[model samples]
Target: MKKTITATLILISSCLLAQPVPDSPAYEHELQIGLAGVSSQSIYLGGKSQNRIFPAIDYQYKRFYFQAGDIGFNLIDSKDWEIDFGMGVNLVGDTDRGDSRLLKDLPNLSLPVSGFISAQYKSKMGLFKVKHDYEINNKHNGNSSSISYAAPIFKGQWLIMPKISYEHHSQEVVNYFYGVNTVDATLSLPAYQTGAVNNIQLSVLGLREINEKWSFVGNIQNEFYGDEISNSPIVEDDQRLSVFAGFLYKFF
Candidate 1:
């Protein structure tokens, strides 16, 4: 897997260098910031649940974007094929009285330091993207990687994207947060173990250009995981869904 990731990154770097440079200013920069709150019934970790609020900032320099606060580093560029790198923090809440059915068993699991690196090629017909990510902390260590494709459903208004992903985690990472320990195991509690997860997702995003400065964006994503990972006692349902709506402010 490491070899594959290295090779893919090398190929992307080569392609980036082969493309002709744009004539525009190479040193130009921009900055933008926003705040957002997300409410969900459940974010499953073994048997834990949490609700979260995230505040975010975005800064761009020519072809790179910095994401901090809520979302981490997310870089995108149009001159050649688009490439992205992302890094962020992950927080999980106490499970005692949470809203999700999946989090009823475990309590208080937090995994910090989450991030990804990705690249894409876009054309009028469609776009193809590949990404790799990691989640690191004292208690947990996991990685995820994926490839996806997107096509315009209504030109400037909507898009449909499909993706296939794989995820793996260390035993400590998995067991600390998602598994039942020996003590709990003796009591017949289900344990979440370290393993690989394979899944597919379909996402749809819609955009509304409100004015020159602000725009509204909405998105929905649905995912289905493969049996090996999805069938675990610690695993939630095989299917997962997410919806988000947000406003973007662009500075010229």
Candidate 2:
């Protein structure tokens, strides 16, 4: 169940804006409970495709919010611009179970908790956002940054959003997660050093409102990795694809 929850959370964080946010005054403090499913390709060598189903929860209370397993607070709330700070789990280390037989002897990587600051701008063209996260759990002691743009389209009771983003992971993060250090080196896996990794992702998010109390949400995304990560000893693919779908019920 840990793996399923981790996968669901990863998808939620990657498609942060994909989840439907009700604008009604009645939903000011909403509790959303749902069941979600994820199908994704792994980058690790010998890693098979992962498909899992899991339950999800989200809640919003004024400036404080909890989405999936992430807890955050809005430090600045405004009409055109907003800034927030909070802590959440990183996507990589947590989900990597080293499922490959080749990686059976590797040291287990623990999930890293990170503190993040995010800034967002809403304009006629689209919604633009920039966010930075630094590991605070003394895991990799690394940091990452991402910038994205999303445009929302409304058609009747359905809302669609297309998004594009670029994310950069610090060298420490790449090395810790993908690099084959002396301690992890095996006869079959040679020691490998890594640098900063960058990724480009495209996503489409959709929501269909069933009623004031219920909605259907879904997202599809493709992420392409940079050479830094793809060239790692344990990595086999340069890209990953993920899909998610769920239903959320709003409770006041």
Candidate 3:
């Protein structure tokens, strides 16, 4: 159930990225419900790829919004700029130990809840964003920041968006997820720690309005890891890929 919820949040986040909020929303109160699935490659050694299907829900009232497990408020809303403050579950970490025998002996890393502030700038060329997230749950007490750009293309009733992002994870975040302490180290897995690293991500999102109340959405995302992460004993891959798709019904 926990893994299902996590995957749902990830897919919801992707879908939301594809459809940015308009400066002036069409509805004062809005709700959307859907079914979504995600297939993701595992970056951990001896870890199997994960596939999950779960329900998605999103709600909005004026400047406040809730999407899946994320809740936020818009601090600034304008035609060209948007600033938001929110709390959300971090989407990138794997917490399940049952997925890999090699990881069974290690302590499980719970998903971190983070508080974030983000700013977005829209222009004719594209949308540019900068965001920062800090762990509020004391899980790792770490922080992350990202910069991204996305451009949208429209064709008839379909919208396609392509995005590229650069992300930085603090050393504490990396250590909590990938590091092996002396006590947990095994013959096959030695103690390891790595400094901060930067990662790159590329994604494309597609959405089609099936009708007034129904819509379809899909996204493909790929992440390339930094050398620090790839060199970790628990890591087996230098990259990960994820694909998600869903159909949604909107209620106003």
Candidate 4:
């Protein structure tokens, strides 16, 4: 795990050295509120699960964006130049699990104060975004980071975004979710410890303005992760493909 995290950091550092930061100041801001639900036909932890719903909201001012939902709260601020800061709680699961066994097995499901800094640059050629974050206060430390690039394949209507991310968690973080100290071991449940994980993802997205108040959004994303992270006894699979269809309503 340590070796993988070191290599990922070195690669991202090399990429930063290879590219020159762009000079520009274009700002966009908005507020959004919506409802989200997830329905999956997969068995989790050897049990059948059902679909769930949750409310979501987001607020943006200048280069800052704030969001709150089932996943907790997130605050993102961008510098006009190529720098940014993000801080928030990252709650797992797309929907609330309530008092299910899944939640019981993972009691401390929230990564209480995860913070990271990022750098991003965009121009006529393409766009680049990088971010790194870690736990603020905890016995088990965990950190994660990602870098992504996007370019226009067919101009404004279509685009492709490719991203790579790495995550490292200390024994504390792993124990909270997958570890079984005597209590869990006696229950005959498998331990959930993980060393580190890396993820590579590719996504294709399209935007269409339907009229003054409505717009159409669609995207397909595929993700592949590294072994320690993906092969963990707790992790379901190493790959995933997701498709989303939604309508955006604008208020101005």
Using TM-score, give the best candidate's number.
3
Model 1 agreement with the true structure over 1-252: per-residue lDDT tens digits: 332222222211211111221222444665544443332333243432222333334565665555432233335566547666656443221223233354444455443455667787867756666766577554466665667666645455333333333334334434554456544453334654655545666656555556766656555555565665455555566665555555666575
Off by over 4 Å in 1: 1-27, 33-56, 68-80, 90-107, 154-177, 186-188
If both were scored by TM-score, which would come out higher, candidate 1 or candidate 3? 3
Query: In candidate 2, what are the lDDT values of residues 137-234, reduced to their tens digit?
Result: 99899999999999988889888899999999999998887888887787788999878888899999898889978888888999898999888878
lDDT of 4 by residue, 134-213 (tens): 77877246666667776644546433333344434444544454444544543445555655555576666555556655
lDDT of prediction 1: 0.47
TM-scores for all predictions: 0.65, 0.93, 0.94, 0.64
CA lDDT scores, all candidates in order: 0.47, 0.79, 0.81, 0.45
Count of steric clashes across candidates, in order:
4, 0, 0, 1
User: On a 0 to 100 scale, what is the lDDT of residue 54 in model 2?
Assistant: 76
Stretches off by above 4 angstroms in model 4 are 1-29, 35-44, 47-56, 67-81, 91-108, 123-125, 137-140, 154-175, 186-188
Top-lDDT structure, candidate number: 3
Flag regions of model 3 displaced more than 4 Å.
4-8, 11-18, 21-26
Candidate order, TM-score descending = 3, 2, 1, 4
Off by over 4 Å in 2: 1-4, 16-18, 21-28
Model 3 weakest 10-residue run by lDDT: 15-24
The digit string of per-residue lDDT tens for model 3 on 1-252 reads 576457445533733532643333546888888888888888889988878777778788888988757789989978899899999886555776327898889987787888999999988998899999999999989999999999888888888888899999999888888889999999999999989989999998888889989988888989899988899999999998888888889886
